[model samples]
Target: TPTQAGHATIFPTGTSPGTSSVVNFAPGQTVANSAILRPGAGGQVTVHLETPMAAGTAHFLIDVSGWISTSGYEPRGARVETIEPVRIYDSDLSGGNLTGARKVSLQIRGAVSTDGGAAVVPPLDDVVGVIVNLTGVNAYGGSRPTHISLVPDDFDPNVPAQQPTTSNLNLVPGQTRANLAIVPVGDDGRIHLFTLQGETRAVVDVTGYLVRREDDTRGGRVIPLITPFRAFDTRLSDFHAQPLGPARAEPWSFEAFVNDVKVDGEPVGKQAGLLGNFTAVDLERPITWYSPVRTHMTIYPHPGGGGEDENCGAPPNISNVNLGEAEAVPNMALLRYGSSGMGPNRLCVFNLAGYVDYLLDVYAVVLTD
Candidate 1:
C-alpha cells in the first residue's frame, strides 16, 4: 500500500521536527484524534487534526487546567434594579463608627451586550423576568445583607415598598438571600435598575443580562446588550402631598395657587417645574429625573391671600423667597423658597388632589427660612 493518506508529526520538545510519525487513518473515511491540550501562561495550544466533520456530527475533548477568577452572573429584562460591581465605599458599623453620614443611590441600567456593544430591542408585549440581590455583611466578615427596600420610580407615595416596620432584620448572620424580584408592565426595552443602600452590613453591586422569550421561536445564539439609564436623588421641597388622610394620620399634602403661586415675579408663573414622582438609587446610573412644567393641579389655602383668616386661619406668608436657577443632577435637585407674603405669617400646605393632577400633592410648609 503506497499510503492511503499521508500523515506527519512534529516533536519540538524531543528530537526532530518531522521525523517520527504515526499513521492513524484509512482512505475513503474521515477521522479525527482528540487534541493534547496543556495550560500555558495566558496561552493555549490547538492541534488541528485533518478531519472533515459530517452535518453536525463531530465531538472532541480538550483537557485544560488553568486559573481564572469567578465572574458574577449577569441578569436581564427591563431591570428596575441592578447592582454594579464597584466598591464605592466601606464603613465599620461597629463601635458606632459612623462613616461621614452619606446618602447612597441605586439604579438599574437597561440591558447591554456582553461585549459592551449596542442595544437590542425586542418585540412588543414580550415580557422579561427581573431579579434583585440584597447584599449584606456578617459579624464574621462574611458576605450577606441585613435589609433591602425596593421602590419603583412610578410608585405612588401612598403605596410604597414595605419597610421593616420594627426597624431591623431577625436572622442569624450569613444566612439570607440578598435579592428581590419584580415583573413590571412596559415595553420600553429597559432594565429595571433598583437603587439601594445599607445601614449595617457590606453591600455588593449587580450586573444584568437578558434571556429570550419562551415562545416557540427559532432558537439561535443571540447576544444581550445593556443600555444603562441611572436614577439620581433629588431633594423635593414639597414632594409629598397630604398622606391622603383618614387613610393616614398626619395628612401630608402639596398644592399651588394662581395668584397664590408666583415664579420669577410673574403671576401664574411657570417657574415651578414639577418634580413628578422623582426616584433615587444607591447605584450609579443616569436617570432623567422628570421636572414638571406646572404641577398637576393648583390649590390654595385662602384666596386673596387672606381668605383663610375668616376661618381663624393665618395667611400664608411666602416672601423674601426666590427660587435659584433650576438645575438637574443625577440624584439631587435644589429649589429655593424665601418669604414674600403679606406679613410674618404661618403657611399650611396641601396635596394637589382636587386642584390638578391625580398623583400630585403639596407636602411641605416653611415660614421664612
Candidate 2:
C-alpha cells in the first residue's frame, strides 16, 4: 500500500543497532516497537522504505514467543501488579469482528478471578512476561491495518512488520492508539493478540507481571544492546543547555530523571534490561519537517518525586524513535528491571511536545541476570 504516502523504517541490516528502530510505516499508517530482540543470527530483520513503494509489494511476518540465554540468563523475581487500566478484551463487548487473521486469548493466569477481582497475573506457575498497555481503539478500515502483533500464541503466525507489539502509528478512520508490549505468556497462561487487517477495538492493560523462580535454573536472556553509549548530553551540560524552551508558565513539556549517573567514582547500577536512545530537540521551532508529531520521549521509573502518576510503572518505555526537525532524533528506549523491592531502578523522561533537550545513550546493559 505504498504508491503514494510514504514512510517505513525497520532495522538491523548490519551493524546499526544503536538501539534498533524496529518498525515504522505510514501511508496506511502503522508502526511499532516494544524493544525486544535477541538476534545473534536467525532472527534477522531489515526494512527501510521511506518513499519507494512505487510498485509496492511488501508483506513480511515473523513471530516467536520465547528465547533467552545470557549464559542462561536467570532473572527470577519481579512481581508487580499495579492495575488501573484493566479491560482484557472487548471485540465489541464479545460479539467478534477482527477481520482477516485474528487470535485473542489474554487470560494471564486467574487474573484475580478472571479480570473482575483484578491483579494477580502470571502467578500460576511463576510466569515470565507481561507489561502491557496495548490499546487500539477506533480502528475500522478501508484497507487500514498498520500493525499489531503481541506474541505468544505458542508459536507460528508473525507479522511483526519487523518486530512490533503495538503500532497504529498513522492510524486513521477513527483513530485510537496505544503501544507498549513485552508479551510472552503462553504456557497456557495466555497472551496472543494478532491483527492482519483492521477491525480494531482492542485494549488490554495489565501493567506488570514477570516472575520465574521455582529454583530458576537460570534460563532467560536476550542481551542485544548492540553499540550505543552516550548517557546524557544537554548540549554537554553546564546547567541545562539552550534548547528546550516554551513553557513560559510551565506547560511546554519537561521532566528529567537521570539521577546519580557516574562511572569511575561510584554509582551506576540497575541492570536486567535496557537498550537506550532518547534524543529530542526543538532548538528552534522544528516539529514537522519530514513529518513527526507527538514530539516523543517518555521513559519511566523515577516516580521518586511524584506529584502523582504513580511513577507510571506499567505502560512505560515509549519512544519508537522519531523527532527530526532541528535534528537529533533518536528514540529507541526499552525497560525491564523492577524486582528487588520494586522501587528505584532509576530513569524518568517525559518531553511530550514542542521544545526538547535530552540525549540519553546506553546501548546495552544486562550485566548478568
Candidate 3:
C-alpha cells in the first residue's frame, strides 16, 4: 500500500505523457531515489507510475544527470553516491529562467567529493560517467508543452529516446517536478541544461559516479541475450518454476551459468548481476489491468545451481530498486557474490504482493564470476 502518492520515471524521451505518474508521492523531507532508462517506441518512453493517484492530485518533478546504454559506456565504471547531496546549480538563488534553447552549464569536477578523498573532478575526470540529480522549480507551464533537456554539452539529446519523467509536465506557476536519469557527460566536464519551450529555474546535485576500474580481472562486463527467455514461469512444467498468484508472495530461484564470455575474453565467474525485464503475465500473455496496492519484486544473488540459499548473508546489498505491479518491470542490480566467486551459480526473485505472474528476459549480465 502507498504511504503517499507519487510517480516514477524508468526511462524517458522528449515530451510528457497524457496521464501518467513518475513518482510515488513523497513527504516534505528529502528522500533518496534513483532510476535507469528503459527505451520505448521511437526510443521515447513515458515515466513509469509506481502508485496510482486517487481523489486528490499532488505535484512532482524529475532530475536526470546520467544514463546507461550498451552502444557506448564507461568500462568497469561504478556508480557512487555523495556523502551529502551537493547542489551544483540553483536558478532561484542564481536568478533567471532559461528561455527557449538557452542552456546552463555547471563545472562538476571539483564541486563534490567522496569520503575516499576523491573529488568529483580529479578522480572522476577519466571516469566513463558520473551520476547526479537534475531538478527544476517553479517551472512555467502554459497551454503549450514545457520540455527540458539535460545532456552532456557534447552529446545531443537522443530524440528517439524515452523521457526522464512522464512527458508534458503541466506545472502550475511555481509548481515543481523532478525525476532521475543517468546520462553521459561531455568532454569539457560539465552538463548542459535546456528547455524546449517556456522558462524554468533548474538545479543540479551530485550523487555518485561510474568509473572504470584499473584491474579487469576483478571488474565487470555486460552480457546481453538476443531474445528474452522465460527462465522461470511459475505456471510451468517442473519442480522449479512455481506460480506466484495475486495477493501472494513467494521466492523463485533459477540458474544463470551458461559458459562465460568476456568482452576482453578473459576468465569470468567472480560475482555476477542480471539485467532483465520483469513481467507479470497470465498463462497466455495479454494486457492486464491493475488496482492500487504495493506490488514489488526483489532480485538477489543466491547459491548457483539450486533452491534459495537460507544462509545467503545479506544478498549483496545493491540498494533496493522499488518496483510496481506493472505488466513488466525492468531491473539492473549488482549481486554481491560470495567469495567462492567461481559461480554465484544461483539467483532468486521474490514477488512482494499482487497476483500477477512474472517473466524475466535477460538482456545482459555483468560478471566478475
TM-score on alpha carbons, each prediction? 0.20, 0.29, 0.42
Residue 273, candidate 1: alpha-carbon lDDT: 20
RMSD of 1: 28.4
Worst 10 residues of 3 by lDDT: 313-322
lDDT of each: 0.24, 0.48, 0.44
Considering lDDT, where higher is better, how would the candidates rank from best to worst? Answer: 2, 3, 1
Model 3 per-residue lDDT tens digits across residues 94-152: 66676544556666556543223545445456654544445554435531245555566
Evaluated against the true structure, the overall lDDT of model 3 is 0.44
Q: Top TM-score: which candidate number? A: 3
Model 3 TM-score, 2 decimals: 0.42
lDDT of 2 at 214: 49
TM-score of 1: 0.20
Give the top-scoring candidate (lDDT).
2
**In angstroms, how far off is 244's CA in candidate 2?**
16
